[model samples]
Target: MRRGRAKSIPKSQTRRPAEAAGEVARLRQELQEARALLRELAEGGGSVVAKRLASLEEERQIARGQAVEAAMAKSKAEGELRRLQAAIDKAPGFQGWLLRRARRRLETG
Candidate 1:
């Protein structure tokens, strides 16, 4: 099994321009559809649709906020994991320590 960290591929190499463009286009279409729906509800003067839209917008905002909070927590955990790994590395190589212990035992015997 591979130990420690693997090298990261560069963004330019890893990401496809066409895929990113497609994602952006999809998001724009979704936004346009939401706007059209809102306009239709306004034109019909449907209070129910308006109320529902407002509720949905509120929920979307809360969910977005929670996502940002979760991302921050994940980032903090990753940083702490790296710090502890570095500390462990500094303590001494495990194989070398075991070999040194064996040498000391043979000498004493």
Candidate 2:
């Protein structure tokens, strides 16, 4: 009769539990470090995100003001054109005189 040999388990498998625990602890430490960095960035004077938001708001206000100014100027010009057209319709010779006066004023100014 031949003698039978016992099978042996690998050494790495035997040490797997401790290695896994160490890996978990290291990962947890890294996570804590990341969280701390985030907290620090948030608590400091100002973050990049906050600065960008402020700049964007300022630009938005400037754009809104410009839009209002443009609307007012357009309304003013339209009113002047209508008034000038009415005057020209009422007096045939007035349009040429008004044009000459405008040109003279522009040249002088």
Candidate 3:
């Protein structure tokens, strides 16, 4: 019985030139497709962000208007309260009945 030695092939001969070229072309096509997808996503995402920013701006304006209105209403209410307090302080009380009676007599005369 005879033992045969296996032939050693070089690393460069492992893949043919045509096969390597085809692989390179396939990889390049995939890269182009990936870039196109990324561009499409970026454009779409920009619009979404813009719309969200606009919505937030509108909400902020509405909130500011409401805050201003609330402040004005509070100031008006405080003024009314102060006027009422001053009027009550100047009005005659039960302890000043004589003064009230004198004023009534003066008015009648």
Candidate 4:
């Protein structure tokens, strides 16, 4: 039998009490946001709500599509934004900004 060495985690992967708490807070905030969205969507039971839900679903499916496509204007940020936006429609104009802001919080905390 052959044995291999276990992988070691980097310092960034280390969990601290503050970090854990912050993560919990963030997750709770996310859950609240999701609940709010559900409530908003459920408020009206008509073609409008159904159309919005269908649009959101279509965005989700497009995001899941796997293909090798050329980048436009050689803009890498656009690609990343589209990928993240497709997955998260709430932050359409602020996807990249929000991601960077969250990273900053993690680094500062």
Candidate 5:
């Protein structure tokens, strides 16, 4: 049997929590900015209540657009995750080994 040396993989092959956290932080900042802009638009001077209502409606439309963009971004991230997972699952002699290590780390700490 040719059960000799196994290849060692680099740590960068797997996704890290830090990257995910950074992405979340960045998205939060964007959402905060969008909200601030909407608030500004809604609070700006208007001659009539109808005008204010229209401005608020515009703000709502902006919020809806932001929500749709966020949804698309989430879908893209999920697709990327699925691609990575599929790649991991197809690797030889590594799927179960990696899963066990992940489970052990999660369970222990």
Candidate 6:
């Protein structure tokens, strides 16, 4: 096999001790700032998620209340319909037939 030429080193790699020390200090400061920024982002994201969760919970509660009100209204209307139907069934003859015809027309409409 043929021998390859030796690799050349960059001047920065042969830095004096003081210069290397300064570079290390600067890198450490940058690392601290990056860590602080990451923490702030994480806290901000958590707060946004928490606020969204609370909003959803409030909406769920409002929907539940509306559902309950709708159920109550449906129950009251059904009771009234049953009472009216019973009255129609008790009606004598032609009047009952007329009422039934009207009810059928309303239902079809």
Task: Give the winner by TM-score.
Answer: 6
RMSD (Cα, Å) for all candidates, in order, is: 20.8, 17.3, 22.5, 23.5, 27.0, 15.8
**What's model 1's overall lDDT?**
0.83
Each model's lDDT: 0.83, 0.83, 0.83, 0.75, 0.82, 0.91
lDDT of 1 by residue, 45-64 (tens): 58767898999999999999
Model 2: lDDT equals 0.83
How many Å off is the CA of 96 in candidate 6?
2.6
Clashing residue pairs in candidate 3, if any?
Answer: none
List residue ranges in candidate 1 displaced over 4 A.
1-45, 92-109
Candidate 2 per-residue lDDT over residues 34-102, each given as its tens digit = 998788777773776788789999999999999999999999999998896666546548776777677
> How many clashes in each candidate?
0, 0, 0, 0, 0, 0
RMSD of 6: 15.8
Provide the global lDDT of candidate 4 against the true structure: 0.75
Estimate the TM-score for candidate 2. Answer: 0.44
**Top candidate (lDDT):** 6
Task: Quote the lDDT for 11 in model 3.
Answer: 88
lDDT of 5 at 68: 100
Per-residue error (Å), model 5, residue 96: 8.3
* Better structure of 1 and 5 per lDDT: 1
Q: Model 5 shows how many backbone clashes?
A: 0
**Residue-wise C-alpha lDDT for candidate 4, range 88-108, written one tens digit per residue:** 534556765686677668769
Q: Who is ahead in TM-score, 2 or 3?
A: 3
- Among residues 3 or more apart in sequence or in different chains, the pairs in candidate 5 whose N, CA or C atoms overlap within 3 Å are none
RMSD of 3: 22.5
What is the lDDT, from 0 to 100, of the residue 67 in candidate 6? 100
Error of 3 at 55 (Å): 0.3
Which of candidates 5 and 6 is the stronger one according to lDDT?
6
